[model samples]
Each structure stands twice: as structure tokens, then as C-alpha cells.
Target chain A: MAPKLGIVAGSGGLPAKLAEKCRETGRPYFVLAIEGEADPATVAGAPHAWVRLGAAGTGIKLLKEQGVVELIMAGALKRPSLASLRPDWRAAKLYAKVGLRALGDDGLLSAVIKELESEGFTLVGVDSVLTDAVATEGCYGRHRPDAQAEVDIAHGFRVVDALGVLDIGQSAVVQQGVVLGVEAIEGTDALMRRCGTLRREGPGGVLVKAKKPQQERRADLPTIGPQTVDLAHQAGLRGIAIEAGGSLVIDRDEVAARADRLGLFVIGCRKPS
Target chain B: MAPKLGIVAGSGGLPAKLAEKCRETGRPYFVLAIEGEADPATVAGAPHAWVRLGAAGTGIKLLKEQGVVELIMAGALKRPSLASLRPDWRAAKLYAKVGLRALGDDGLLSAVIKELESEGFTLVGVDSVLTDAVATEGCYGRHRPDAQAEVDIAHGFRVVDALGVLDIGQSAVVQQGVVLGVEAIEGTDALMRRCGTLRREGPGGVLVKAKKPQQERRADLPTIGPQTVDLAHQAGLRGIAIEAGGSLVIDRDEVAARADRLGLFVIGCRKPS
Candidate 1:
């Protein structure tokens, strides 16, 4: 008999990989994968149940029924369609506890964590199982930012860090010496689109993304992947820098290959001076 | 004939009023208004010239031709259009002279001011004309934020000020304890739309718009009014706070009346605790 862990899975391959890692480590895990967000293959080797993100409370109930002790949350939850999230009685109660006109990504996650902890389900970090996934410091790929792009990267990193410190946002767009855009709840993708729509040479800026300095662990972390790289290439961005070890690098090889082909510099950046 | 001052105008009626005050105080002023931003009437009384925002050289030339001794930059410039600004030789030269990539707003403006002074225009502050137009400390409307909203406002003010210090932005969208959006080049109106689109309910949230603590006084001063109030109502924001004396209050009658009708509190927010 192996130690049983509970997995709250979101969309993407990360959930599947996490489940595989648990099995390989001789830990039997019960996965509650979000419908549409999680890969269909997430539960093939693991005892798993399908759950919609809107029904997260129900997932917790299922995990509890499986006699799981520690819960590991992994992957990305599709942002809930506010109009469609039909909260069950348990979810409704959780909602009542979060009193506000709106909840930011961090606020909502913290509230959810509190609710789970109060219920006797111990929460664990998403990366606790896969430590090697965090990108190393310095440039990750073969291509590096050009002299001008490097300057923009430095500028973008500082602006993004400033936004993070204010707990407002953690992404910024910079070109030459001017900022093209800053990310808010609309996310990095939208910010790229706006920069493209607003500027003619569109993808000529640099995009920097990072986690807020004071963000609670075991919650939302900055993430990037092939799509992000593709979007940057499409938006005419010259380069991108993500904080080393603090962000999820999904399909790093594919992202790097895309960057190489597009002549865009994609690297794990350090703290800008 | 009165001594002429140069009124560098951007958006809204603040430029108009600044010009009116200069006239009332017996000074003939040359108004240099950004074509798409200024109220035509604000410059109608003065010897005014229209210049596109990115054309710093044209702005300088206009003031110089009018024999203007003192320059007063009032109102807000649309964040320079990254996609469409067509700069002349002077603006190109000015851009070259000020080449730091991540320089904050004050840094950029100081560069612009230094260039203008080098060319001999004396930049002045709006307080020299109508001191009453400067906001004072206190809640300006009928509704004071309830305890929760007050906490939100205080937190939001701190966040906005931190952002100001880094020159990332100056406004934030706060609801309860969460920040939904922070103003960048897109400005407050766009941030309001992002909040409204993301979380479509509640009596409304709090919007804190402040001037950067170390901003160049003669440059654009943050201003709010009826349109802002209307935007708040449409976006479901409960209130707004502008910095006292550090901002401009334009079209007060309409703004206050609209706010009262909408049950939205429009306050003159001070520096945070």
C-alpha cells in the first residue's frame, strides 16, 4: 500500500505529468481534473474523477471520499465564466466568506485555500512533486536578446517588478525606451494584442512577465508556453524574460524552438537592477 | 495688452479654465492645445495653436512664435499613440537626447522640460493662476466609503502611490480587498471597462486616481469630472478619489450632481496612511 495523495488538476499536460510523477514515486494519487481544462488522459494510470472548475467544492468532496490526506493542486484552471459558474451549496458558502465587489487572481486563490484548509484538507505546493521543472537562472534557450532588445528587457523587467510590488500587475511591454503596454486582469495575451493593435510595427517591443513578490505560495504562479511564444512572435515582440524558478515553463523545448525560428529572444531573466 | 503665458493643453476643460484664469488675472496667454484632446472653447479666447501630442518641436515653435515667456502645461495628454505619432525633426532630436529605456514618467517629463528650457520656454504651474481649482482634503460627495470601502481606498491609495513612485501608473481598480486593474497608457476609462467586463456586478468598486508624488508639476496634472463619474456609473464603481491639491477638478457641478444621482462617492483622496 502506497501513500495516497489528492490532486486538484487544471487544464494542460502539467496535470498528466504530475499524475505520472506520483505513480512513478510509488504514491497512489486521486486526481480531480477540471473538465475541458485537464487532458482526457490525466486519470489513465491514476484513480481520477472529472470535475468542472465551477464545481471545485465537489472535487474536494470526491478527494475526501477517496481517503486522501494531502492535496496537491497543479495545472491552470480556466478562468471561470462568471455568468455560468453554478455554485453548489458548499461553493455558495465559500463565496459568502469572500466579501468584495470582485476578487483578483491572488485574492480568490487565497480565499479558496482558506476554505480548503478549514475543511481539514491540507494543501501542498504544485511544484512540491516536480522541482526540476523550474527554469534555471539566466538565458534558457540558444538565442539571446539583441543589444537593443536587452535594453528593452531590462526596462520591461523593472516595470513589471514595480507593478508586482504594488500588487497591481506583473507584466509590462517595452520598446526602445518607451513602454507599449502593461498587463492587468486582461492577462499577457490581451496586453500583447493591445500593443499590436495600438502600434504599427506591433511585435517590436519586449514582454516581461513575473510573479508578485508577496504572492502566497501554493497559489497562482506566472506561466508561459508555446502559445505565449507564438503570440509574442505574432505581436512583433523582439524578446521576452520570465523570472527564473518562479514561473512554470510549459513545453520549454517547443517554446524555445518557436523563439529561435521567429528570431525572438526568450530567456529566464534575473532581477533587473 | 496683457502679459502672455503659454498654456500647454491636453485633454478636458482644465486647460480651458487655466487659460480663463490667466485671462481673468489679466495675463494674455498663448494656448498650445493637443488637437484631439482639448475642449475647443478652452483655447478660443487665447492666441492658441494646435499641435499633435508627439510633435514636441511644433509645440515649442508655437510658444516661441507667440513670444511666450512662461509655459504652463495643464490637462492630460493622451498617452502618446505608439502606433500613430508622427514626430518632426525636433521631436526626433528630443527623443534622441533623452534615451533611458525605463525612465519613469517624471524622468521622461524632466527630459522634455530640460529640452524646452534649453530652447528658452519658462514652464509654470497652474496654481499660479487659480489656486481654488486645486482640490482640498476631504470627501467631496454625499457618500463616504463604508468601513470596508475605506480600507479598500486606503490600500488602493498605497498601491497607486507605489506605482507612481516607479512611474508604472497612477490609478487602481479596487473592490473589497482585491485590485482588479491598474492604469497604464490605457488610462482610467479603459481600466474601468476591464473591471466592468471581468466582474459584472456589485454596487460598484473604488477607483483611486492620484498624481505621482514626484511628478513634474508643470506637466500634465490628473483631472476627473462628469465623464469620469458617468464611466464609474456605467462600470459599476461605487466611488473615486483624486489626490488633493495635486490634481485638477474639472466640471465640478456636473460631476458632483451626476455622482449624487448615481449614488457614487467622488472623493478627493489624500496621500495614504
Candidate 2:
């Protein structure tokens, strides 16, 4: 029998969708919803507990009490700061240990994953549960990338690779052979919207996303959904290119249909090793 | 006597400042003020001709007519587009030849430099005329980068170096070991303002500027002025770091004085070759 799962929900509908998947499969799941970040509806009908991000000690205790041996962290959360998080004793110790020693968010996440494993919980990636979430190499919709867009996608990847080498960002926008913007702490969503206004008159931009070179796969794989298609179209973009097998496509069919409806190409390129 | 300098002025005070230097030094010069971008004050009392950016043919004609033998391009200009520029016959020819093949703005600039040389004209960097414009290695003000700021500045350079590898941009903002933002089509001022809101708690960010790896130094060297110090301060940044010997710091005294007054460190770093 599969061990009962702990959904460490943060924000977005992915957690809810994961819960629904577990319910359909008759797999018992308990949600440890992060206070403030996790959408409330994620725990509406689930056996769960709300815990402040800073109070990981209590969260761990609750998960153990609920008999959750398998864990999956979902959705997005801000990079925690001492002032913003007000870490409890356990969290404080972790923060002090990892936060100072790490150079980037991925380092801190790796530390967290190690801590969770040492606590006897085996952490799983979201894609393991939502099998269809993993993106593969191919054009997903009716629209295909033109020669110019193909070049731009290549350019975008080079830029993303450079950013990742610094452990900086996973996405970049390229239009007419010019890098329009890069995702930093602002995120892919804002990066797309900002690049929208910066586009030149020629071929529209391409939104390219990939995992950082040193990113912790179990913690954060780059992700896009139908909403990403909408944002791309709104940003006057011509296509979307994500690292194949290194990124997630939430609701793939919906994303392809949306991209088709918006006259945009959605292709997955193999990320260089 | 100084080879009859031709100032191909773009937008901003740099062109005007360069013109003033020529006037003060009693060097014969002519200003080829671009139609839409060059500030009027730049040529208010100088030997100048207003020419559409698309009318490069006419500008070249006027430069020869004025006996202009040496040229210097100064200040900032948007990356031109066919729709926005409405290229003239000669400009159209040049654009058609260079636009499609170049991967980025620097490539286009390099081609333009080659074209000017083919036409028997010499091009010079901004630092040549404005002797004090060249930034050299050192902390320029009362404040020095603290240990944390020093680390962030080093981190910022890694980000900038990665950006340069792709010919992306000249600047990036990093705070507490995290990249806050990078400049692309949005320019440096906007990059700083955008980064201000994205900064993490603890130490403020540092603005780092460097030339692209294959940049056309004579055409578009990385530059900063007193206004940059103001922007850095307003962005809640602790300091400014620019590539020493590879970037220009206009009005060095003013930049230093302003940085001192604002309690910000303005350092020139030795760029890695």
C-alpha cells in the first residue's frame, strides 16, 4: 500500500488538484497548508492543518501525528526573511544554518529537503503525482514556431542558461533577437508582462523557461499552465518554449487549446545538460 | 586641429557635455543631431545639423560638407525598428544588410562602425574627449562597500558577466546574494527603480554595470553619471559598481560628491577579461 501523503500546500490550484487526484485514487492524504500562502480552498474537504511558515516544528509534529510518511510541497512562496517570517525555534535553527551558508534559494531548498528526509519523510516531486504535469519535447498546439521564432527561442535559452549559471533565474523573454527582460526575484509572470511593453515592431517575443543549472528538482521545477498561455498572448508573444522534461505543464490539454485559440506556439526544447 | 570631430549625438546630457568640451578646448567640431532622439540643447550654440535617424545618407553628406573627419557617438538611443525609423535610401540599404544577420544590438553597432570606417571616417570612444569620464579601480566616495555589500557586489558581477556572455545588457541589481533585476530593453534607470521594490530585507542592493563581452567599445561603452548615483540611492541601493577601465563615469567629481552625500559607495571594479 502507498504511504499516506502529506501535501505541503503553498499557493495556487495545484494543491487542490493533487488532493482531488489522491481522493479519486483512494489514497489518504493530509494537507499541511502554509498560512497566508496556501489557497484556503485547497483544504476545504481534506484532513489538514494550517501552520505558519515560520512554525515548521509544529507542522512536522502535525504531519507525524497524521501518519504522513510521503510528502510533496506545492505552489509558490516568497523567499523567507527573518523579519517577514519570525521563525519559530525549529525554523530559526534551520534558517540560521542554511540561510547564511547558502548563496541562492536552491541551496536553502536543498537543505530543507535534506532536513525533511532526515525527519523520515520521503519528499516527492509534484510531477510524480500529476503524471501529465511533465512537459516533453514537441510543439503542443496547432500553431508552430516560425523560423524567426525558432531563432528567438534558441536565443532565449542561451540567455536563460547564462542566468541559471549564476543561480539567478529560470526564464527570459526574447523578441526580434533582443532580450526584452529576465526573471529575477520578480518571477516569470511579471517578467512576461514587463516584456510585453518592451517588444519591437517585428516578430513578437518568445517566453522561454528552464530549470536553473543547480536547482533542486524535488523543490522547484519550472512550471507553466493555461494561465501562462494567456499571459503570453497578453504580452504580445508569438510562442512559449520550456525545457523539455525539466519543466511542468499543468493541465496540458487546456494549455495547448488555449495556445491554439490565441494563435501561439507551445514547444518544449531539450534543456542542455 | 583635433581631426574636426563630428558628434553623432543621441539623447541625454552626454552629447551636450561632449560638445561643451569641444568648445572649451577650442577643437573644431560639428554635431549631427539625430532628429527625434538628440536633445536640442545639445546643439543650441554649436555647429550642428538636424537629421532624421533614417537619413543617415544626408547626415553623412553634411558631415563631409563640414569637413568632419573624426567621429564620436555619444549618449543613449532606443534600438531602432523599421516601423518606427522609416529608413531613408542609404539607411534602408545599411539596415537591410545588417538587421537580419546580427544576433543583437552590439552586432549591429559593430557593423555600423565598419561601415563608417569603409567611408573613411574614424570613430572614438566618449572617454577619449571627456578625459575624466574613464572609471578606474577604487572606492570613489566616503562610504566603502561593507563586507555584506562587498559580497553582494561580487555576486552582482557574476550576474552581469552572465548577462554579457549573451550580449544582453550592461547592468544588474543584486541584494543580499539574490539578483533583484537585470537591464534589457527597459534600460538601467528602470532596472534600478524596478529592483527597488524587489529588494530583500537586510542589506540594500548594489547596482553593477559592465560592457558586453564583445561590445563595440567606440560605439556603446558602459556609462554612468551623477544621475546614476541618484538613481542608486533612490532605489535603496547601498552602492554602485562599474567595470573599471572598461566603463565611463561622466562628471566623476559630481558622481563622487553625490555618492558621498547620499552615503552610498561608488566603486570601480576591475572587470574580468
lDDT at position A9, candidate 1: 80
Query: Lowest summed lDDT over 10 consecutive residues: which window, candidate 2 chain A?
Result: A99-108
Could you give candidate 2's per-residue lDDT for residues B150-205 as a string of tens digits? 88888888778778878788899977777788888788999998987877667788
Give the range of the ten consecutive residues with the poorest summed lDDT in model 1 chain A. A194-203
How well is each residue in B1-273 modelled by candidate 1, as lDDT tens digits? 645788888776678787777767777777888888888888775788888877877788778888888877777665553346676888877766776445556787878788888887777777666677677777766777887678778878887887777676778877766676777666778778878875534445688888887888777667787888888888888888888878877767777788888898888866744
lDDT string, candidate 1, A27-135, tens digits: 8788887787777777776788887667766877898899888887776554453435677777777777885334556676788888888888888876676676665
Against the native complex, each candidate's DockQ, computed on alpha carbons, is 0.28, 0.58
**What DockQ score does model 2 reach against the true complex?**
0.58
Interface RMSD of candidate 2, in Å, is: 2.0
lDDT of each: 0.74, 0.86
Indicate the DockQ of the complex predicted as candidate 1: 0.28
Judged by DockQ cut-offs, the docking class of candidate 1 is: acceptable
Q: Kindly list the per-residue Cα lDDT of model 2 for residues A1-273, writing each as its tens digit.
A: 678999998877788888999999999999999998899988998988899988989999999999999999887766755566778898888878776522677777788889889899999999899888889999998899888888889988888888887878889998878788998878889999898888878778899999887777887788899999999999999999999988899889999999999999999999766
lDDT of 1: 0.74
What is the Cα-based lDDT of residue B19 in candidate 2?
Answer: 91
True contacts kept of 1: 0.39
Best by lDDT: 2
What's the CA error at residue B184 for candidate 2, in Å?
A: 1.2
